[model samples]
Target: MAKNMTLLWCTGSCPCWRAMIALEEKNLQGYNHQLLSFDKMEHKSQQVLDINPRGQFPTFKHGDNVVNESYAICFYLESQFKSQGNKLIPDGPEEQALMYQRMFEGLTFYDKLGNVIYYDWYVPEGERHDSALKRNKDALVAELGLWEGYLSKQGSGSFLAGKTFSLADVVVFPTVAFLFRFGLSAGRYPKLEEYYALLKDRPSIKASRPPHWLEGPEEELLLKEI
Candidate 1:
């Protein structure tokens, strides 16, 4: 009811960004936000540990109710503050189901992309498996196309959930953003390219972009151009 929300998150964490976007989307103002650092192990501090034993980022506290995990925090905010700004979960049963389905699909898409990033880029050259890398790259390309197709099916809408920017967009935005950061081009997925451009300037998105991304050099890309 009051502006008593507090968020503890790490920079560049996609899950943390999800909570930040949800808060901004709700137009919930003046909430306390603390930036933690993984490099410094700030999340493992006693204060954070007391609230969240796992010491994970995207820790949320609404008065006395504490919630950790990105999706859980986002859902908690959406359900508790539905009267505020844009409705994230949507109203109808079918639309709600679709939003949930698409949101999880976003996770699958990220897992596919993550495999490529981990094996091809993060792993040492000698340690990386060529067969696995190739498989991941192919899977990433296919996953990107699946999202492109979802956008195409929207016809007039620019968002994945149709007409409005829902939880589906919030869930998928970071994955795509990560792809872009890793030098994947949106050029091949025309519909996704358009949708990508559309979300770039959203107030919540602009506010929630990883701060280090502004200061750091772009990561070396691994996925071949599709």
Candidate 2:
């Protein structure tokens, strides 16, 4: 099965990282993989467009099956290879419910973060308003606070869904890492900081650490104030 899989991804894309981590946690080895350059706009190249019309970072294929969306790819892998690797979905009903909740909630979290991070890129400087940017950042800070509360309720050494790592962790960890990578003040969210620290060394995360991240210094602090 591994031999039949192929993945095309770009470095430092959290969605791409999610797919990479899922494959690693599934212990799916020997799969064909390619690293494209976002700086060169290779993610929008013909090769990626052939499989994914959107020309997304992650164009994954399992035999004839193509799963482009990162979260969908993770879910598909877990469902098809349930017995092959670490069980991502918890066995208990309540745990599974929480995993699903957090996993979907992660989408909102990502959207909020993206609004702030990409504000300048998306909005023209002349049209960009400080008020709008502050609103976006404030929303992100509140989102982070909500996550911190969730983690606090779980106590120390607890995964997003429960004691054991689940699909929730797989889905959300990259966004959290992204926050820290852009200098989301660790002191303000100790629980999130711990979560980031704990998961950074996880085998899957270490193995799939963003290639470019290892080669360069961290980028300018985007969320330093928050």
lDDT of each: 0.81, 0.92
Residue by residue across 1-226, what tens digits does model 1's lDDT show? 3368888889888888888888889887579888989789988988789889998887789999998877887788889988888889878887778889999888898789778776644677787777877877888888887887887887744578767789988878887777777777766767766776889779999988999998975766665374
Provide TM-scores for the models.
Answer: 0.89, 0.97
Model 1 steric clash pairs? none
Q: Any runs in candidate 1 off by more than 4 Å, and if so which?
A: 1-3, 120-128, 224-226
Q: Write the per-residue lDDT of candidate 2 for residues 1-226, one digit (tens) a residue.
A: 4999999999989899999999999999779999999889998999999999998889999999999999999999999999988999999999989999999999999999999888998899799999999999999989999999999999999999998988899989999998988888888989999999989999998999898887865767888898
Q: Top model by TM-score, which number?
A: 2
* C-alpha root-mean-square deviation, each candidate: 2.4, 1.1
Off by more than 4 A, model 2: none
